[model samples]
Target: MSTLYLLHKPYRMLSQFTDKQGRATLADVITVPDVYAAGRLDYDSEGLLLLSDDGELIHRISHPRHKQPKTYWVQVEGDISEAALKSLRQGITLKDGPTQPAKARQIAPPASAPRQPPIDPKRHPSTSWLELTISEGRNRQVRRMTAHVGFPTLRLIRTAIGPWQLDGLAPGEWRTETLHAPRPTDKHPNRRKAPRKDQRARPAAKHRKP
Candidate 1:
């Protein structure tokens, strides 16, 4: 069995357990030993993060090759034009390359608690909320994509990762659950031959025969 935990990580907290600079880290919130974050949420961003002690499970969740979808609620510094939304859905070009098609749409402000240092309205007068889901995890991909569309992301929060969600979770809160599915097994290319009835090991001749 593996240990899995879902946490609502607050903004400005390091994803790892330690930071030499005395900054806040997961250790400050969770006390579980041997568990590590499956995927990372940047220190500047906040929301659902999965942790586990199982290496294979962690790879399944975090590896880009698996194509697990991650959903984020982003607040950008613009009114967010239709063209911009279309661009995101169609895939935005970044310095690395063109991104995969993403699911994006306008959304009302989330009902979550305000950020510790609330986004200063004076800094970004007009802002819009957008829900974007992407399968690929690039470094700062969401922020870069939004910026590519001419709307800088003011605040970003991941709400979902694959089948798990952050429902009812408050900042710095965590919950553990057993993995419902069986662990992944190695694939065998060649089929094994079954034993014939005569070849199979049979119970010793009945002693009753004597």
Candidate 2:
């Protein structure tokens, strides 16, 4: 049985346990030994972050190939247009490459926890909320995608990652849960083996240097 921690990472804090730049880190919040963050969030971003002692579980959660869905509450500047929402659903190209299609929709402002310092509304007088769910973990992908469609992300908070949700966790709080999901192994279970008949090769090709 592996232990997993559901942490509510506060805004402007690093996902790591230690930081050389004197910025706040998980050490300031969580004290569990031997548990490392399964995936990470940007220093400016907030919300659900998972930590686990199981490397396989971490790999399963973080690897893009797994296509584990992660959903966020995005606050973007200006009213997000339907055209933008359509493009987000269909997918958009970023500097790295094209992003996978995502679930994006305009939503009423979520009654989320207030930021530590609180976001300044004056910087962007007009803003709206969006619920965006994506499977790929690209560098600043949600922000880039929204910007490409003419709306820049003002704030981001991951609400859920696969089966884990941020529900009931306040800022700087954490809860532990033991996960038992078929016990992932390091072996490649999907590799195909050569057929027995194919393994028996011909003596030689007919026209070779006999």
Candidate 3:
């Protein structure tokens, strides 16, 4: 039995327990010990971040190799056009690399409360909003990809990660639930296998071996 928490991390909150400058962290919001964040949302970003006591679950959720899809609502620094939307879906090249093709589309303004310090008002003329879903989690990837297409992200909120969603969680709030671990026979079990003992001990038996 593992303890799983769906936390809505507020803006300016650190993902980890400790900060050199004594900033806010999961410790301030969640009292549970030995629980670690599965993936990270930047301090300036908001939304669902999974926390758990099970190390294997953490690895499964956070590691890119697992291919968990994350969905985000991003407010960018310009009105998004169909051309921009197409570019995003096709994949955009960033300084790091070409982002994996993403599912992107225009979306109605989100229903969340207004940001405390609202996004820059001066940029309102240029800003627009979109929803993007990507299976890969790279450092600041969403912001970078949007910027690469000439729309710098003004605000970012992750709305979903795989099967979990932000749902009713409010900013700075957290809820714990029992997450059933996928069994060996479950769909998409980690499939890499170790080599057999004989296979490891013996050299290549092929006729073309050097």
Candidate 4:
């Protein structure tokens, strides 16, 4: 059995258990014995964060090879244009390299709890909401992608990861569930089976009266 913790990581909190600078961290909200965060939300980003004692779960969520989809509701400065949305759908070229194409669409404001320190409206007098889903987890990839597309992200909130969602969770809150088995789509990694030998029974040679 695996122990998994679903946390609504508040903005400005580190995804780690502890921070030397005494800044906010997962330790402040969750008190489980040995669970660690799966992947991570940036220090300034907020929304669903998955934590677990299971290493396989952590790898599936964080490893880019799996191409697990992570979706975010991003608030960006200025009105997002169809062209910009199209670029995001195509892919962005960052300093590192070209990113995998993403699922990008403009969206109405999502209903959710406000950040502890809300993004200043004055700073972003004109803003638009967007739902972006990406499979690669480059560092600050969402922010970079949106910026490259001409709309600087003002506030970012992850809404879902693969089969998991931020639903029913609030900032600084957490819940636990014991997974008896992986979710259907998240079943164990596949491995080819070795070929089986013939299973047919041959008729015994009639008792040759030797």
Clash list (residue pairs), candidate 1: none
TM-score of 2: 0.86
Off by over 4 Å in 2: 183-210
Q: Write model 1 residue lDDT over 90-202, tens digit each, in one string.
A: 99789999999999999999898689999998988899999999999999999999999999999999999988899978999888878866333323313223322322212
Q: What residue pairs are clashing in model 4? A: none
> How many residue pairs clash in model 2?
0
Per-candidate clashes come to: 0, 0, 2, 0
**Residues 74-103, candidate 2, lDDT per residue (tens digit)?**
999999999999999999888898888999
What would you estimate as the lDDT of candidate 4?
0.78
For each candidate in turn, the TM-score is 0.86, 0.86, 0.84, 0.85
lDDT of each: 0.81, 0.80, 0.76, 0.78
**Ranking of candidates on lDDT, top first:** 1, 2, 4, 3
- For candidate 1, the TM-score is 0.86
Q: Which residue runs of candidate 4 sit more than 4 Å off their true CA positions?
A: 183-210
**What's model 2's overall lDDT?**
0.80
Model 4: residue 23 alpha-carbon error in angstroms: 0.2
- lDDT string for model 4 (1-210, tens) is 776777889999888766669998776676665567767799999999887666676655666666779999999999999999999999879999999899999999889897767778787789999999998888999999999988998899998988888886889887776778764334455422221111111223341110
Tens-digit lDDT track for model 3 on 46-137?
99998766666666677667688899999988688888889989988877788888999999888875676887677576677899999987
Best by lDDT: 1
Cα error, candidate 3, residue 45 (Å): 0.8
